[model samples]
Target: MDFREYQRRARETDQTPDTDGDGLIVPLLGMAGEVGTLLADYKKRLRDRDTYRLFKESIAEELGDILWYVANLATKLDLDLDDIAAFNLRKTRERWLHVGEKQGRLPFYLLFDEQFPPEEQLPRKFSVKFSQEKQGSGATVVLTWDGQTIGNRLTDNAYVDDGYRFHDVFHLSYAALLGWSPVTRKLMQRKRKSNPKVDEVEDGGRAGVTEEGISAYVFSYAKDHSFLRNVGALDYELLRTIKRLTASFEVNIRSPADWERAILAGYQVWRKMRESEGGTVHLDLVNRTIAYSSE
Candidate 1:
C-alpha cells in the first residue's frame, strides 16, 4: 500500500479516542520498543541460519507492526511519514553514493576471533562503531552474544582517503523544523563543501527530485507547512535536544584516539537514554579495533 494507507491502518490499530487516556508519546515509544525487538529477532534468525521462509515472514510481520505504530505516531502529531521517508532516502543516497571523495567514507573492519568467530560458532559479542573526529561525533554499537562481525568490505571507490560523517542532517532537520536560525544550514553548507558527498546535491531521479533532493527539500518544506507548526512547536524540545546530541557526537571525528574517546562518551550517553534498561553491554569501534564491555 501507499504511505497514507500504511498510516491509516496504523492509526486504526494504535490510536485511541481523543479522551481514551492515550497520548502521542505512549505509542511512539511503544513503536520504538517494537522496532528494537524486531531487529533483535532478525539477528537471531540470521545467526541460526534459520533463514526459512517462515522466519522471514515472522520478521516482516513484526517490522510491519513497528512501521504501523511509527505511522500512527507521525499522524497523531500531524507529521508526514512520506516526507520523513523521502528525506531519509535522500540522506541514505548521499551517504552511500554522493558524499565526500568516496575515499573519505568510513572504513569497515570486521573481526572473526575464536570467541565470536562466525555465525557457525557459539555467539560471544560483536559490535560496530562508526565515527569521525572531523565531523565531531561518533557512535558505539553493541551486539548480543549471538552476533558476529564479518565482511567489512568497501565496494565503492568514494570511501578512500578522508573520513566522512552525515549525522549533522539530524540537527539540521530539527533546527529547520523549529524555525531556528539558519546557522545550522550554513554550517551544513560548509560541511557539504568540505566533505562534498555527505550533503544533499541536486540530481534527478524516480520522483521529481532525486530521492536525496526530496529529503533536503522536505526538511525545508515541512518547516514551512502550516499544519506542522503545532506539531513542530510541540516537538521543539526533542528537536533541540537531538541537535545538541548530534553536535556533541560530530565533534570528535578528527583522529582515531579522538574519535574513540568521543564515541565512547556518546555511547555512554546513548546507553543511558536508549538502552539502559537492558543488562548486557558490548560496544565495538571498528576503525579503532577496540571493544568496551560492561557487565
Candidate 2:
C-alpha cells in the first residue's frame, strides 16, 4: 500500500487516543523499560558465556514496541513515516559525504582518496525498505544511525542528538519552502511584546494588518510582480487560481508564536487552492519572497 493507505489504517485501529494526556509518551516509556530489561539479560548472558536465546527474543519484542510507538507519534504529528525515513537517509548522506565524492568520512575513518564502498561492501545499517512481499506491502523504513560505517561506528549519544537536530532542520526547511505572510510574523512579534517577561520592545503600530487586507495585498503583489509573472508565464491558469485562493477570507494564522503553525496553515490553504481547480500543478518555491533567501 501507498503512504495514504498506511496512514488511513494507522488512524483507524493501530493508534489509541489514551486520554491520560501523555499520548504516546506512556507507551514509549514502557517500551524503553522493556528494552532496559532485555539489555540487563543480554549483559548477564554474555558475562556467563551462556546461550542468549531469551535475551535476543526479549530485545526483538521491545524493539517492535518502540517502532510501534514511533509510528504512533508520527501519525499524531501529521507526518508520513516513509517521508521521514527517506529524508533522514538523504540527510545522512549529505552530512557524511559530498554528493560527488567517492570516499567519505565516517566518524572514525578518513578515506579522502578512496572510492565509496559498493552497496554489498558498505556496512549494513538498520534497513527500512517497503517490502512488496509484506502483508500490506508497506514501504520499508530503515534506521541505521548505530550501524558501523567504514571502520567507525556512530556513538549512541551522537545518534540521538543528530536525529533531533535533523527533525528541527526538516521543520525549518519545510517552513521556508512554503510562503507565509509577513503580517502573520508581525502578529507573532506583538505576542512577544505583550508578555511581561520579554523586555526588548519595538515601536507601536507594527504588525497590525487585518488578515483580509494582507491576503488581498499579497495576491495583488504576486499578480503584478515582474519575476513571478515571467516564471509563472507558462501556466496562466496557476496565477488565476492563486488569485482566487487569496480571495477567501478564512485566514487561520492569528498570533506570533504561531509562525511555524502559520506556515503549515498557509500551505494547507495553498493545497486547497490547487485542488479546488484540479491537480496540484504549477507550484514553485522559487517565486516566494523570504528575507533569508536573499543570499
Candidate 3:
C-alpha cells in the first residue's frame, strides 16, 4: 500500500494511539526495542552466513515491524510518512548527485577572468610532473611543469610522513572539478592580472592560503577516517565547514557533492601517488576529472 494509506491503517494498530499528551511514549519505546531486535537478527545472519536459510524471512519480518513502528511514531509526531520520505529522498539526491550542477568555460563557472589571456588563465588541461627528493630527515615533493619548477617544494612538515606533500592533487582536483583553485592558479602563473581587483581578491595570497587551509583541514579529517579510503560519502558538517571557509571567496557557491567528488578524486589519485612516491597529476576541466600517472 502507498505510504499515506498504509500510515492511516497502521495508526489504527498503534497501542499508544496519538492522544492529547504523552501517549506517544509507548511507540517510542517500541521503536527503540525493535531496532535492538533488528540488530540481533542481523548478527545472526552474519554469524550463520550461507547456512542461515531463514535470514531473509526474518529480516523482512523485522523490517516490516520496524516500519509499522516508524509510521506510528510519525503519526504521533504529527508528521506525514510520505512527506518525510519524499523530503529525505530529495535531499539524498541533491547531496549525492549534486542536483542542478553545471559546467562552464571558467573555473567555478565564475566569469571573473573569462576575457583574460590563455597565459593568465588556469590551464584547462595540463600535467604537473611530481618527483620526491630527500631533504634533511624527511622527503619533500618537487612539482614541475614543462621542465620548470612550479610551486615551492612541499613536505608533510609533520613529525611523520602522511603524504601531505602530494596534497596538491586536491588543488588540482578543485581546478578540474570546480574550475577554482588559488593555489593552482598561483603555481601555474594563471592569476587574472588583467583586472587588479580580481588579481588581489580572487587570485591573491590570502585566497591561496585559504585553499591550503582547506587542504590541511580536510587532510586532518580524512586521516582520522583512514584517508577516506572506501568512503562513499563525507560528513555533512565537514562539507558545511568547507563551504563556510570558502564563503568569502568565489568557490563558496560550489555544492556539497562537488566538494565530495573533488575530495574523493584527489584521494584516489593520492593513493597512487603515495604508492609510487610521486607521479604526474593530470587535470581536465572540461570533463571535470583529475587522474595520476607514474612518472
Q: Which candidate number has the best TM-score?
A: 3
Q: What's model 3's lDDT at 140?
A: 89
Task: Order the numbered candidates by TM-score, best leading.
Answer: 3, 1, 2
Q: What C-alpha lDDT do the candidate models reach, one value each?
A: 0.38, 0.35, 0.84
> Evaluated with lDDT, which candidate comes out highest?
3
Tens-digit lDDT string for candidate 2 (1-295):
7645665665665545564457667656766776787778778788866555576677777676666666666776667888988887754453333333245421222211113223211121121111011123221111122332111111212322111111111222222333332232232221233333321221122212333343443334433543132231223343334334434321221112122222333334333322232111122223221111100
* Order of the predicted models by lDDT, top scorer first: 3, 1, 2
Better of 1 and 3 by TM-score: 3
Q: Higher lDDT: candidate 2 or 3?
A: 3
In model 1, how large is the Cα lDDT of residue 276? 31
Per-residue lDDT of candidate 3, residues 1-295 (tens digit): 7899999999887665645455677776777888888888889878998988887788788788889878888887899999999988865764676544454332335533467887798777789988999887889899999888998888988888899988988998888888889888888888888889889999999899989899999999999999988998999999878888889888776777788888999999998999899989988887687888996
Give candidate 3's TM-score: 0.68
lDDT of 1 by residue, 1-295 (tens): 8897777766776546352247766776778788888777777777877454467777778887777777777877788898989988854453234223267534432322223214322122233222212222333322223344322221212334211122222222222222111233242222223333322231112211222232333334333543133331223333333333334232212222222222333333333323232233233323322223334
Winner on lDDT between 1 and 3 is 3
Residue 193, candidate 3: alpha-carbon lDDT: 85
Candidate 3: clashing pairs of residues = 107-179
lDDT, candidate 1, at 48: 75
Provide the TM-score for each candidate, comma-separated: 0.32, 0.30, 0.68
